[model samples]
Target chain A: MKVIETINLSKIFEGVVPVHAVNQVNLSIEDNEFTAIVGPSGSGKTTLLNMIGGLDRPTSGTIKVNQIALNELSENELINFRLKHIGFVFQSYNLIPVLSAKENAEFVMLLQNIPAKDRIARVEALLKEVGLEDKMNNRPSQLSGGQQQRVAVARALASKPDFVLADEPTANLDSKSAENLLDIMHRLNKEEGITFVFSTHDQRVIDRARRVITLEDGKIISDVIQHEN
Target chain B: MIFKVAWRNIWRHKVRSTVVFIAIALGLWAGLFTSAFTHGMMNQKIDSVIKMEMSHFQIHKPGFREELQVKLLMNDGENIVQAIQEEKEVIGVSGRIVTMAMLGSANKNGSVRLNGINPDDESIVTGINEKLVEGEYFRGVERNPILISRKIAEKYKVKIKSKVVLTMQDMEGNIVAGAFKVVGLFDTQNGMYDELNVFVRRDDMARLLGVGNSLHEIAVLLGRHDMAESMADKYQHVYPKLEVLPWMDLSTGMRMMIEMMDTYTFIIVGIILVALLFSIVNTMLMAVLERVKEIGMLMSIGMSKTRVFMMIVVETICLTFLGAPLGILLSYGSISYFGTHGINLGDAAYADMGFSNVIYPSLEYMDYLVVSMMVIIMAVLAAIYPAIKALRLKPVEAIRKI
Candidate 1:
């Protein structure tokens, strides 16, 4: 089943001169799909991802996630929707600095009001799966760039989200750390069947994606699929 | 969890948090200390007035206070005094013959209110005997011996045993003059009262005024000052023909001063807290601004705006709680120490104000509780604007903030 579908999604930035950041973009991602939206600067890859995650409202379009129209929800309702269904990983590794890796992983489920026992069990398992079990007590500042990003992934998966939206998640990492992060995410995607839609400029990330959609000037230029190397 | 996060968040900037904590602590300490000191001064002044002049309550014939006419004297003054003395609450009572007269010395002359008293009974009521600075208190002196303040002695260039003349009209409307020797010079710490009043034997005063056994005022001292009003009310019922006045009625200025003291303290502390309020708001706003990206991340991870707001408030409250109790305890310790040891203003400064040089600072525990609560409330109020500012951030945009 399609987990996310966007029909004619458009966003316009009004300024001294109008800028069409995303124009009439139609996209669909299936469950457990490892999809990459690849583009150069000004190609609106982040804007498209923001729209799909309900982080930004579309200027004119309908984004349906699991049959719920994202544009029809109120601001507060959209926040709840994102909290329950769509997790996010930002380029900057935006982990709460004061929280340790384990606490950060448990944060989303805590907000969901899940039972403390289940929250702790799920967070422990997710941290172990992401190879961060031993580093669970270290705060983000104590962790390296790779470790912090891994904690972010564990946090995103803690809520059992339907899909995870990642915007340039590997852009700030060293090459090896980037490759390791991609391996962990790919493994989680394969083993847990957790779908992921990422916006990236990194060629290494595109190389690993199962499907790639290339955009230029806010329009899709190509859509292609690749088998395992 | 929000509390845990908030508590950890404040310590992230150790220097900044410590600075705010110390500022609040010092502000509260200063406010409490100032209040205690002011209360001490006012209390001393009030106590002096009640002890040396008004006592707790006084009784007089109707219209006597309005005009000091000898005809408006209590007809049964001894009976009223006996009744007051028999009351369980009454500690002391004094009957006085008061008359306006001109006091004349060899070098100076002034108009003064002459008070006639039984020296022994007056001593119990006003402690006048304890205030004698020279010679004896109307003891072993010749006929018509008198007590004069040191201010009056210095003004008249007279000393103990110097003879002075008093002239006044008798009750029969006849003008009379009498000569008296100054048996004692007293300093009441009240320059105005010292200059305006002279004490003479009630027998001598009555003989000169030709009104035998007539008393214009009956002063009553109570064991507990808090019972003054009720005692006054009871006295009025027992002696309906006479006017019974509590210290508050006899001295309106003192009453007004006491009433305004609490209001003044509140205004003063409120102004201090307002200054603190601005400082706290500025600091919390800076904290929120510095953590925009992290705040956005939390919101994006499903933290509600209300939760974010409460986190800021909790952080502020923790900061306040950290400082307020320390400040209050510090103030309490300091006030208690000084209350026992006393803070001495120079004698000359307090001389004219009817106050002693040494003032013992005091505060009720309720005042500490009130001031601490005010500081906490101010802190919460101060946090609101910053918390609302944190809530206004759009997660998408704030996550992009550098």
Candidate 2:
């Protein structure tokens, strides 16, 4: 079943002359599918990804995730839904600088008001899974780029979200770190059945995704499934 | 966990956090010092009034306090004392005689009020014996001895054992003339008390006034300091004709003026606090703006906007908590240092202020706590606008901030 479906999604930055960042688009992503949205700079891949993640509103359209319409939720309900159902990994490896690797992973769970014992155990297990158990106590500045990105991945998975959004997650990483991160993400997707959607221009990432969706000038050009379920 | 994270965040940006901490600390310190000094000054004034003049409570000839002349005593002075003695809260009660007299010395002269009191009873209200510098206090009611103030002594150059003549109208409307030996000089320090007041024994006053064993005013002391008001209320009901004036009423002008000074001090402090509050608000707002992308990232990771708001507020509270106490501590040290060796507003400046030899800025611990709490609260309040701004920020726009 489609875990996320976008119908005629569009976003226009209103001004003296409105700039159409994301034009009319329709796409569907299946559960547990590793999908990538690839485009050049200002090609609206990030904008399209934002709309799907419920991080933004479409000027007109419907985005359904797990069969619930994203556009229909109030500001408050959207926040609650996101905390429980959606996770994001960004290019900046945005692990809070002050928090340790483990703490960065555990933050979303804290917001969920999860009990401390469960939170601690989950964070520990995730850090180990990310191969950051030894560096769990290290803060963002103390960690290498790849290590920080791994923590970010661990954080994204900590909430047990049905879907994860990665926006240029490998942009700041070297080839080796990027490869290592993708392998870990792929493993998590296969083993845990967590869905992954990434917005990226990295060919290595595009070559690896089970599905690829291409966007240009704010509209999807193609939707191709390259790998079998 | 939020508090722990917030706390660590403060230390992460060492220099910036330190600056903020110092600002908060300074705000709190200044607030504490000002409040403490004001409170201390008030306490000092009240103590002086209670110590030197009004003995907690006083009974007077129904109208004698307003009209300054010795008059008929309370109809039942002994009975009143007996009644007061029955109340556990009554510390002590005394009979007092008050009359106006012309005071003269070889070099200077002034008109002064003479208070006739019992040596033993006066001791119950205030430390009169300690204030006596030159000579002994009156031995008994018949000694015809007087204790004049140090200022009066300085003007008269009258030594202990010197005889001085005083003239005043007695209660019966007769002008009584008498000579009394100056046994001691007291320096009460208060302007009104020091310059023109003398003390004589209650018996001699009764003799001079021709009131046989009757009292002009009954002064009662409370067992506890704070009970003066309630005690006075009881005294009022007990003796309708008698005026029950607490020490607060005795120095009304001084209290009012002190309160006025405190109000002015608060206004000045409040202005500074508001400025500090704005500085804090501006800093937080700037921080929120700079971290918009990060905030969006957090929200996208399934963290709510409410969580974002809480995190910002936690950071603010952490910063302020870190700073406020240090400021209060510094203020305490400064106030203490100045309190002992007063600020010395310069002798000329001190004189200009119409105060004594020194201007002491003193405070108590509770003053520090209260002020620190207030500054912290204001600092927290300052973060509200920024926190709400963070909550209102759309995740997409914030993440894509140019």
Candidate 3:
């Protein structure tokens, strides 16, 4: 089941010399697929991921998530679509510093107007799965870098998005923390059939991904399937 | 959830937020207290003017006050006074033989407005008897007794039982002079009023000026200050030939002073609020700038612009309210304390300028509410610039920033 598809997607940042950040990229992401969009510096992995998640307006081309053309949506509609369908995990842990771990985890569900009881139940389960149940009441400042990332993960998944987008989620973590985060995500992808698309330079993330899509100078150079469940 | 985030966000920088809170509180306290002081001073001036100089309103035959024409006297002064005294609002009425004259002592000569009145009626109308510092209102000297202000006495080198000659034109336009002994010295605390006025017995003045029983001025004191204008209007209509004026109209400068002071009070409060507004704007802008990455994350996760804006506004308002209550309590406490105990501005300059030296700071309940409303409005306005700054954040770019 195709959850995301991009047809001839391109983005040009106009300047003294216009830079084509993402050019003529065609991609498809299916449900339960653990894919990594891999590239070096100045490559278009992050730009492509942003367009697919409805976070940026494409200069040209149409991005369809669940068959809804993202380019056709207004700014407000795009935000609503992202809230309902997509989750984001950033390179730096972006958990609200003022909120507790549980509060941060429940933030998305709260935005979705979910019932308090259901939200509490789901958030608790997600935090426990991320192994932060013990630290639920702790603020981000009180948590380790890896623990904060885990809270971010729980928070992204709280609204039960159709797919989660991870943009170098383990870039700032240590080797052990990175390995732990990848394993947790891999387990969720397999057991719950959750889809994830990561944009990363991290070899560890690429090694764990079931499919690797490589890009150079904003164009796809290679796509290789590692293993399928 | 947005409110929760906003509330917690304010306390994130405890020291900064506290500073902003204190700034707002102190600003409000200063503004309100200053307004109270102004109000107290003006109220005192108004009370003194109504009670001593101009008794709510006064009446005179048309053209009598402007020219001091002795012949243009109100021939039916006694009837007019009797009729006005019948009104329920009327507290006291006095028909006066008023004329501008020269009061000459042996050593010096001074210009004065001679108020010739029945001693009892004059005392009731202007409370002049209570202001006497020495001697009596109408007694001590048998043949001709006159009351002089301390300013007049000091200037003319006269005292109780000292004889003074008043010279003025009679109804026939002939210059007539009479010697009257100063029986009392009164101090009205109004320098200008005390300097220019002297009182003599109406019968003595009438005999000296040969005006028979005609009165040049009729002063009426009303129980309530607010009733002065309507009663003046009523009397003006009843006696169309007479020029009736309320205390506010007797001297247009007095009216202007009252209005100008009220305006100045609000302006002073407004200036303080505006200064505080800038401080709040700067503080909230810093708060927004500090959380660029976090705010971007919230937006990237689908928080609407309105919610983002409201979050900032609520945070700013929450911060302001922290100080607002403290400021209001401070203002209230100080106003109450100073109002009762009085703030004696140890300066005779105020008395010399026709105001009491001691001020009792006051504010109407409505004015307090108005000041609070102004503060709330200021807080909201202050939040706008910073909230807009937050709303302008683009998640794509802002996330890229550290």
The candidate that wins on TM-score is 3
Candidate 3's TM-score reads: 0.97
How much DockQ does model 1 earn?
A: 0.75
Each model's DockQ?
A: 0.75, 0.61, 0.82
- Which candidate's lDDT is highest? 3
Cand. 2 Cα-lDDT: 0.80
For residues B1-402, write the lDDT of model 2, one tens digit per residue: 768766776676688778877887787677767766665555555666666667677777666777676665665787887788778887777777777886655555567887788788787766677887767777532458888877678778887877777788876677887788888888654555677678888778778887766777777777665887778877888778778877777556865767787897788678768977887788778778877877877776666766677888988887777787788779878888878876543435323222443446777666566676677688679879988988877777777674
Report the CAPRI category for model 2.
medium
Interface RMSD of each: 0.9, 1.5, 0.7
Candidate number with greatest DockQ? 3
Candidate 3 wrong stretches, greater than 4 Å? none
Worst 10 residues of 3 chain A by lDDT: A74-83
Q: Kindly report which residue pairs in candidate 1 clash with one another.
A: none
Worst 10 residues of 2 chain A by lDDT: A220-229
**How are the candidates ranked when ordered by DockQ, highest leading?**
3, 1, 2
lDDT against the true structure, each candidate: 0.89, 0.80, 0.91
TM-score of chain A of each: 0.98, 0.97, 0.99
Arrange candidates by lDDT, descending.
3, 1, 2
